[model samples]
Target: MFKKLSIGRDGADAQARGAGAEQRALDYLRRQGLRLVARNYRVARGPSARGGEVDLILWARDGTLVFVEVRARERDAHGGAAASVTRAKQRKVIFAATCFLRALAEIPPCRFDVVAIDGDRVEWLQGAFDVPAEH
Candidate 1:
């Protein structure tokens, strides 16, 4: 993966870079034949509680509902961009997916995906995570 881009100071710059990464990921997925269903789909459980969000919700050619999380890093270090998707992040994405599914009459085969952008290079990982099994 490429590793030369420098994100500017402040939260806004990081947000802009994140949005750019998402756009790049969306374009790549579109080229791969995935239709966009939603972008930045979000939900909140309560007024005081943290919410969930899915970066991109897409429909694969085979009819799978794909929930994608787009991540970016200036350099691949300490496990890189893909490894940045931690368990807490996965839970938020999963929670958002559940909320999204509730609106559908029939649940389709679903998957969690990651679009990790390391500088200028991008990688798409299918089934990047799953709903954690209960104890």
Candidate 2:
């Protein structure tokens, strides 16, 4: 099944591009005074009841934990890359975040953020979504 959904070259290319975009976004966030905490945090194991991952985790000056989703697109001809984070995706992020917090002896206030990189422009959406109840 994993082989069936393999992204192949295109997927690899997209991942590289996304990584570049994420680095830029992280730099921008740091310039704005947000402290960097973690990156590419994986929570799941495999595809089936497996594991999942979070793109970035950050810390605010006020002690807020930020889970960031970095998205990039050449243009918004469709809904743009930011729109790709659907409700289901948000849930996954929330779940992963919960797991991250649980592993910590101290949990802090946190929120979901989405950074959209459209060409040369980067837009940051803070508190993009609420954590799901089950998490």
Candidate 3:
């Protein structure tokens, strides 16, 4: 399933860039045949806990539910886009994915993916991260 996304018209430059990167990643995924399920999925843990957000969720052709994180950088230096997804970031995305799964009637095979945008390059990294053992 697909839905219209209102992105890139925001007031903040960082937000705008993030939205643009998300749009680019979404387009790339679509071209690769992954159908979008949700966008910007978030879970608020309140003052007591760390909250989480996932940039995009999609349904793969193989029936896998994909949770994606989009990262962007002007250059691929100091580890660049993909490297920006640190351990804490992985925890946040995993937390958000857990919340997303709770709403499903039947959970399918799932994996975390990352779309690392370094300048004009877009790299699709499937199984980019996993739920940490403690989670």
> Against the unseen true structure, what C-alpha lDDT does each candidate score?
0.93, 0.84, 0.95
Native-referenced Cα lDDT, model 1: 0.93
Q: How many clashes (backbone atoms < 3 Å, residues ≥3 apart in a chain or on different chains) does model 1 have?
A: 0
Number of backbone collisions per candidate? 0, 6, 0
The Cα RMSD of model 1 versus the native structure comes to 5.7
Cα-based RMSD of the predictions, in order?
A: 5.7, 5.7, 8.5
What ranges in model 2 sit over 4 Å off? 1-9, 46-50
**Cα shift from native, residue 42, model 2 (Å):** 0.4
lDDT of 1 by residue, 21-43 (tens): 99999999999999999999999
lDDT of 1 at 49: 78
What is the C-alpha lDDT profile of model 2 across 18-102, one tens digit per residue?
A: 7898899999899878998899888865454745568889998889999999888898858887888888788778767877889
The superposed Cα distance between candidate 2 and the true structure at residue 111, in angstroms, equals 0.7
Lowest-sum lDDT 10-residue window in model 1: 42-51
The residue pairs in collision within model 3 are none
Model 2 scores worst on lDDT over the 10 consecutive residues at: 44-53
**Residue range with the least summed lDDT across 10 consecutive positions in model 3:** 6-15
Q: Please tell me which predicted candidate would have the highest lDDT against the true structure.
A: 3
Relative to the unseen true structure, what is the C-alpha lDDT of residue 86 in candidate 1, on a scale of 0 to 100?
96
- lDDT for residue 13 in candidate 2, whole number 0-100: 84
